[model samples]
Target: MHKFHKSIFREYDIRGVVNETLYPTDAYHIGRRYGTLVDSRLGGKKICVGYDGRLSSPALAAELIRGLKDSGMDVVELGLGPTPMVYYSVFELDADGGIMITGSHNPPSHNGFKIMLGKDSLFGAEIAGLEKITEYKEGFGSVTKLNIKTRYIMRLLQDCIIEDGYKIGWDPGNGASGEIVQKLCKALPGKHFLINEKIDGKFPAHHPDPTIPENLEQLAELVSKNKLDVGFAFDGDGDRLGIIDEKGDIIWGDQLLAILAQEVLAENPGATIIADVKSSRLFEEEVSRLGGKPLIWKTGHSLIKTKMKEMQAPLAGEMSAHIFFADKYYGFDDGIYAALRFLNIMQNSGKTASELLRALPRYYSSLEYRIPCKESDKLKIISDLKNALKVKKASFSDIDGVRVNYEDSWWLLRASNTGNYLVARFEAKTEKKLAELEATLSGFLAEYGYFLEV
Candidate 1:
């Protein structure tokens, strides 16, 4: 009934439009196959399941759970919650693994599963492997559903709040986060303002992602309008954070990681901080300035999480708002946890968000530019662009995409792993250097035959 093949499965996770690439029967089959795989890999023989606020999430989660349980894997249904809550349930329950049904920041039609195997990100090829077991049409198992929301809530409150309370703003964007924000607010002693708290599958207010400046515009307004210290926005699934200061600036994902790592390194001297190539060079510099080692890793929550576990890094982040803290928590990316940590940092740092940004100046940066393309042509563009850059002898690293570092600035061009777009970022020390970096982009675009408006 399901198209059991690699087409639906992707590098980071399993994702596709509902009824097209991902159907209910497909979800059921994938669940069974996953259960079989878990049986062989993790002896715990149990799984935690959670879903986002997507239109198709409930059906997908139900059928997916049926598949997992049909393969003899016990299921703990976490109901509708953010992806981070599902991840937290996995770690706290001491289960073998878990799956968060989420489209992430994709459009309303998209939905997928964020996989975890023995507490590590089961992504890329690992996710692609879902087809192997389903090819044989594995046996069905039983699902025992148990609500774990309370346990999950308590885990978030565990040793999270700092000594002093702080005022804050929370915008769930009418997504799944509202399910728990009410419970979470009970533990924190702060004057909190919540917006779009309704768990609407349509995401009527705005796209559930905070990383995109356009998506976070409301939270920025909420901060200044409420006279709050800061505002926090979560993606549809709650694994990514979009932060807004009282002054209405989106304190990007990389910057938030820097702020968190600064707190971490003071306690654990010279600890490693991992960040994606999309992050500014200043992230590395800041980590080093604080006597911590910074490693530039590829972009993607799953990739960063795996690398964080491998390197045992205290902190890891992507510019898109996926921040991981291995030093104090279970190390998987959790936007809610990251928000709490930011508040804790504020309590300790004794500086407002605007003041912190004013003080931590280094380079002028451009927002991530997403250039659309056919998914089929994405790899070809990367290859062609790589060749073009090679002819110029411009120094570059394919760490995530092509990060060509220059004297005063750097430009990184890479294809998105999850979607059909070439994401690029540029940073420079001066306005002149910025233009130069932007100029280099046009040449690469022309060579690749991809018209990108800078």
Candidate 2:
């Protein structure tokens, strides 16, 4: 029996540093366990497996497939592509379950698995149960290799109807989305300028996380140099997205959500639109103004997806750039698909990206701040903070974390589900109020001996 580290099984997925917290043997065990779960519990036989551009992904995927075959589970092998392609295969191929071997926005040295069983992601208690599996079934199972790239691209193209030939800039940041971006651009009606389109596990051009403003410098430069209408960037596994306007100013995730919501609301009035708790107040206000019901839910992608299903929401997004559209397509976060949807909106509106997004009310907002904390202490700190807030009679929502609401400002502090850190953000109508809110949050953390610097 392999003794898997508890830390690797996160709230959302299985992830860890390669050869350290995670290994080939671990991947094999995971496959054996997951295959058994799929067959015995879900009564499923076919599973689709895909990998990202990470160097360690192929070997891990190969071992995983072997273990799955050993457990008598037939595998549809999606050779190499983004995480969303694996998700697409589940629906397009009508498979029982799926798994994408990716590290997402994490560094090159890390790798992990994002899993689905019957279209819904395996998370929370389901993920926790993987550690307890001790038995594996042995039998012969077949493997079918599949190339889903062209079909996936065609699906995206068919969904979007772009008539305008707007000059667009794209930066895949040398991640899994590189090839897909290149192919999609060729088919779309636009003057496309793309950088770092080569799929490289090393991520030579920059870190693949577009959420970090530093990583988007190259894309901004590309947009500015060409005087393009807009720019887009993708993360490591091409699940999250980042955007730059004509002036090379970044359209943050909440702002982008506001733009997308306008189009969605027009099509489906009074439809529930979900945003993560970390999203700005402007998003909620905009959705309400557009006659759409706004819901602020938990932060993780899987959690949000489940909530979307429960509420039957047409559109949903996070501050981290994970946008899901159930309006006209499958409700999975796909960077390429989102980029096209935005392009279609731009084309139909005959407006520049800046003009389309300029109407969103602005606030003095801080970028997401991550503070390192021990995995063991993360939950405890949050619990203590909540208790402290309760005693103070603070106006806050504890949906995912504690988001303290004020008359003209709000701030959020939550433990990151994917890492050993506490993530925080602040927004206010004025800079002084933003500073005051930061101070208030810092003072609260000080009680727990976690001093924060604004």
Candidate 3:
């Protein structure tokens, strides 16, 4: 029996530092356990496997495939690509399920797996069940290697109808989205400039996460230097996106979602659109004003995806830049596809990216603030805060954590599902209100020995 670290089995996926909390043996065990679950519970026999550009990914994927074969589950090996490619392979090939070996915006020293069972992402309890493997199978299953890149690119390009003329910049940040972006750019009609297009596991250019404003600096410079219409950056596994406008300004996730929502609402009026709790309330107001129903749900990608499916929402997004479109495409988060959609909107609107985004009503908001805390204490702190809020009789929403709502201001403090930190955000009609909300939330945290600076 292989004993695995409990910390690796996170709420969303199995992830940990390589050679420390995670190893190839652990990957094998995960594959075996997941294979058993798929075979017995889901009545599935075949599974698709793919990996990212992380250095540890290929080895982990090999061991995982070995374990799956040992457990009598056939593997369709998608050699190397973004996480969404594995997801696309699952649907395009009509496979039972899929798994992508990726750290996904984490540092180079870390690696993990994003799993799916029958088109639905396994989360919370399903992910927890993978911590132990009690079942075993004897037969050896087959393995077939497949390259779905061309078909995947074609699918993305099919719906993208944009004329040739605009100047655009792309920065993959040396992550797994490089090769596909290179190919897609060739087929795209425009003056496309690319940087850090090589898929290197070391991420020599910078960390692939665009959510951090620092990561967008290079792309912003590129856009500014070239006077491009817009610039786009993708996360490590190409699920999340970041955008830079002509003025070298960062268009945040909610802002981008609001821009896309206009087009979606124009086509499908009164459709339900979902945004996570951490997103700006302006997104909710914008959606409602456009004749679309807005739903605020939990913050995790898996949670939001599941909620979108349940509500049959045409579009959904997060402050972290994970945008999902189900209106005319598969309901999965794909950075490349979202970029193309944004381009399509830009071409049709005849407005620069900044112009369209700046037209939206703005509010004073803070970037996501992560307060470091022990993983074990994260939930406890949130629980205590909830109790304290209840005693105060404050108006708040406890769907994910505690999002205290005011008439013209709001603040959110939630334990991050993927990290040992409490994530917080504040927004208000004015800077004064924003400061008051921040100070209020800060006072709450100070009681718990966690000091928040601004």
TM-score of each: 0.95, 0.98, 0.98
Model 3 per-residue lDDT tens digits across residues 342-421 = 99999889999999888888899999999998877899988998898899899999999889998898999999888889
Ranking of candidates on TM-score, top first:
3, 2, 1
Look at candidate 3 and give me any clashing residue pairs: none
Which tens-of-lDDT digit does each residue in 1-454 have in candidate 2? Answer: 8898768999999999999999999989999999999988878889999999999999999999998998899999988899999998999988999999999999999999999988999999999898999988777788999888999999988888886568989999899998999999889886999999999999999999999999999999998899999999999999999999998899988888888998899999999999998899999889999999999999999998999999999899999999999988889999888888898888888888988777788799999988877878888988988998899999999988799999899999999988878999999999999999889878877766677766
lDDT of 1 by residue, 1-454 (tens): 3455446688888888887777888888878778878877765577889898888999999898888766777788888888888788777878888998988878899888888887888987777777766443345455666777787778777757565456788988877788788778877787888888888888899888787788888887878887889899988888888889888887888888788887899989988899999998888878888899999998888888878878888889989888888876888888888888888778778998877666565798988888887888887877877787799887889877788888778998888887778888899999888878888787767765777687
Best lDDT goes to which candidate?
A: 3
Stretches off by above 4 angstroms in model 3 are none
Candidate 3 Cα lDDT to native: 0.92
Residue 290 error, candidate 2, Å: 0.6
Record all residue pairs in model 2 with backbone atoms less than 3 Å apart, i.e. clashing. none
Better of 2 and 3 by lDDT: 3
**For candidate 3, which ten residues in a row score worst on lDDT?**
130-139
lDDT scores in order: 0.82, 0.91, 0.92
